[model samples]
Target: MSPTIGAIVIPVSDLESAKKVYTALYGEPHTDQPYYVGFNVNGFEVSLNPQGEGGPVAMTDVDDLDATRNALLAAGATEQSAPRTVAPDVRICVLADSDGNPFGLRGK
Candidate 1:
């Protein structure tokens, strides 16, 4: 499947503060939870991740999460987290490139 950037996740130390800022910038969020907050701006998803360790991670959508994850691993990416269901009908996996840049793969 052709890859597409599904979401851009930002690491926020303070969830409430970040949420307020994002809310002002993107208007009301479609998703609001302790672990995550999500906003849709012009069809692009922007999310705040309170547990994120460092920089933002761009989640790419794939047709098959496992297959794409395996392919990325074979192509020199290291697994950071295995695929897991985050919400109903949504699954995601995290990986890091050779330079330790984190990214994610998402699928339904």
Candidate 2:
């Protein structure tokens, strides 16, 4: 089987609001809307699903979460949490769209 992160559908409270938040965060328009707002971030397929339809926050893996989070914020992505050390040589963090769905960032 081919194992890889393909796409995630996040449920937001509102599509328009989610669009604004995602656009500001991603710095681009969703591939499509009123259904799916898709984006490819660092090779990860991400789609913003409207509140009722969108499922949950889609988090991607990374090597340096602190640095990644810093970079994301610099790019206008909001930090849901600072880098949190979970285990030795490992940590995780979260970022969110304007509506508050939690997209996670992890490192080891």
Candidate 3:
């Protein structure tokens, strides 16, 4: 199956400032914390991460994280991070394309 974008995480130097701006555009966030703020736009998750560097990274949902990650690596994508569990059953990882643009993969 093909991967689909599930979330877009934007990097911010100042969490509070970014929160204010995003909140104004998308309304109140469903999840608010010091490290991350999340808003549900329709069914998609829009998040702010102070720890995230560079620009926004799009998180794509895949069926098999390991297989897909390996395929991407074989296709010239470099691993920025290994797959790690975020929530109870949710896992995520970061990778950069050949040109060095970062993207994310999220799965169970």
Superposed model 1: Cα runs more than 4 Å off: none
Local accuracy of candidate 1 as per-residue lDDT tens digits, 1-108: 699997998999999999999999889999999999999999889999899878898999999888888889999999988888989989998999999999999996
Full ranking by lDDT: 3, 1, 2
Query: On a 0 to 100 scale, what is the lDDT of residue 72 in model 1?
Result: 91
Query: Which residue pairs clash within candidate 1?
Result: none
Per-residue lDDT of candidate 2, residues 15-80 (tens digit): 778778877777685476576677777766666756334346555667666777788788777875
Worst 10-residue stretch by lDDT in candidate 1? 48-57
List per-prediction Cα lDDT, in the order shown. 0.92, 0.65, 0.93
Give the clashing residue pairs of candidate 3, or none.
Answer: none
Q: Tell me the alpha-carbon RMSD of every candidate.
A: 1.0, 11.7, 1.1
Q: Which RMSD does model 3 reach against the true structure?
A: 1.1
| Per-residue lDDT of candidate 3, residues 32-51 (tens digit) | 99988999999999999999
Judged by whole-model lDDT over C-alpha atoms, candidate 2 comes out at 0.65
TM-score of each: 0.94, 0.44, 0.94
